[model samples]
Target: MSVRCLLPLVIVAIVAVSGANFKRREFKIKIDGEVSFKATPPLSSGKTITWKFKDLQGGVIRVMDFDYDESATPQNPLFKNCASADKKTGELTLHNLTENHSGLYFFELNGKEQMEKFPLKVMRVVQKPEITNEKTTSNPDVVYLKCKYDKVVDKDAKISWSCSNDTTEELAYTKTGKTDLCCACTLKNDVSQETSDQICESDLFHEGSNIALTVVLILLFILLFVVIVLVLMYRFNNKFHDYVFKKYEKTTCLGGMLKNLDQCRSGKKTGVKQTDVTTVYTEVNKIEENNKEDDPLTDPQHDYEEPQSGDKQTDVENGTPLKKEDNTPTEHSDDL
Candidate 1:
């Protein structure tokens, strides 16, 4: 063969060998599951790894190295949802994965040395579909029923509803990826006792919407009542005061004056009129004088004179006699 013909074979062989060197991986997980991708061996010095994701929509997303020393942070929508990677071995850990995470994952080493491709498929299962409404409708003979559950994005995940485990008839269901499903059906009022509220709870009892709403409404009402009471207390300060002087004394100090004042105001004091009493004066040393000159009743001038300073008394016969109105001889009465 010529050199040109041999050159084509060499290029074809090189392409085939390079394709064979790529590592392919398959990972199957449920929706909202977590997974980790670890490097088989530690990376060499001065060597870094990068991760890329290609979704079914033909969109590509790239993630930076695990070592923060290379870059403090990288801008990627999936990076916020994924876990950090190993600093030494460059292993990547993903967390809280959703159906949107299903895609082709690529791990490149040293920018070109080796490429590891991972084909990931996230399968979702029903997490106990909720029974929204299962009650009698306006028509007495007809009853209404409803149910809810998470959205299923894949075609393989089957969502359905049934009654009493009977396959004689199938219940109609609508599927969508945007929001959780809500389906309703009408039945006759005469339902079997086995397919009552108890069995419906077994179908979907993860929530009690009516009970939760009632409790929330009660709490809000109580909060509103408390707020109104506080506002009234603040506005009508004089009407509702902490200190009620009418019921009790606001202040009382220790003292007799205050005690008397309280007594006087309460009309507890006794009453009495003040009057002057008669006082009698007596002469201690003076004796009754029978002589006309010394007798206080006989002579008004003798009553006005004071007695001698010392304790001396004169006898009626020895003292000088005063002149009487008539010159009668002085009789020495034995009584004197």
Candidate 2:
């Protein structure tokens, strides 16, 4: 080949070789910890990859090496130093691992391929699980049981599910990115009245972490008790009002007074004569006046003063003065 033709050919060969190496050298990240599962990155066809862990002491810990065959028995690499891998699924497990095992790892594919670096984050599983019930109603068709941790857990960690009252078993569906996991269960029978006594529990196992849900039910019971007390108080107040009205009816003479007055006006029998009414009214007035005079608060002289003797004589000659009692006080004349 001519010099110019050879240069283009050489460049094409170098480009082809670099492209092949790039595909084979693509690195994948695997996160492992006390409770984390092995995570594999998507790999291209015909690629080979190996995992090596680098400790803080600069010591290289060989994890695993495997070829990327789309139809391989163990598709994922199994690190003898760490844990084994499932044949069916490409899941890797790390045993007796700590956070210090967490760091950057390097993967070397085929010979003459560049090494690829990945980050292996090792997280401590939550020691205790926090369980909560978010249902607000007394009886709910479905109840949410939330199992959460204070921090973010590994996304590929294996979680186990269980309950306190074995009458109903809980199942965990998926892992949440926020280190918390939640599951929903349908209530088999009506539990409106029975929820106070029944408790729901969730157990998460990074290393046997568990949480119970009983405090929420206790609070609901206290609220129900308060409502019952208020209802009883309202009933008592209504009964008290009725009792007061009945007592007042028995003590007062208003009924009797009205009945007597009605009979007198209707004239069913011989009613009181006008003269008799006038005489009785005059006697009652005299009694009321005597009572007033006896009271020191009343000035009897100002209330009943007599007219002069001259005025009385003139009134008598004119026939305007009625018969007067000699024993009556002089103040009585002024009153008339």
> Of the candidates shown, which would achieve the greatest TM-score relative to the real structure?
1
lDDT of every predicted structure (CA atoms)? 0.52, 0.46
TM-score of 2: 0.22
Q: Tell me the tens digit of each residue's lDDT in model 2 across 268-324.
A: 345543224334545988999888877755854645547775655436557676555
RMSD of each: 24.1, 22.9
User: Mind giving the per-residue lDDT tens digits that candidate 1 earns over 210-283?
Assistant: 67889999999999999778545533454442223223333454233323333442343234222111111012
Poorest lDDT segment (10 consecutive residues) of candidate 1: 275-284
Q: What is the lDDT of residue 43 in candidate 2?
A: 42
TM-score per prediction, in order, is 0.34, 0.22
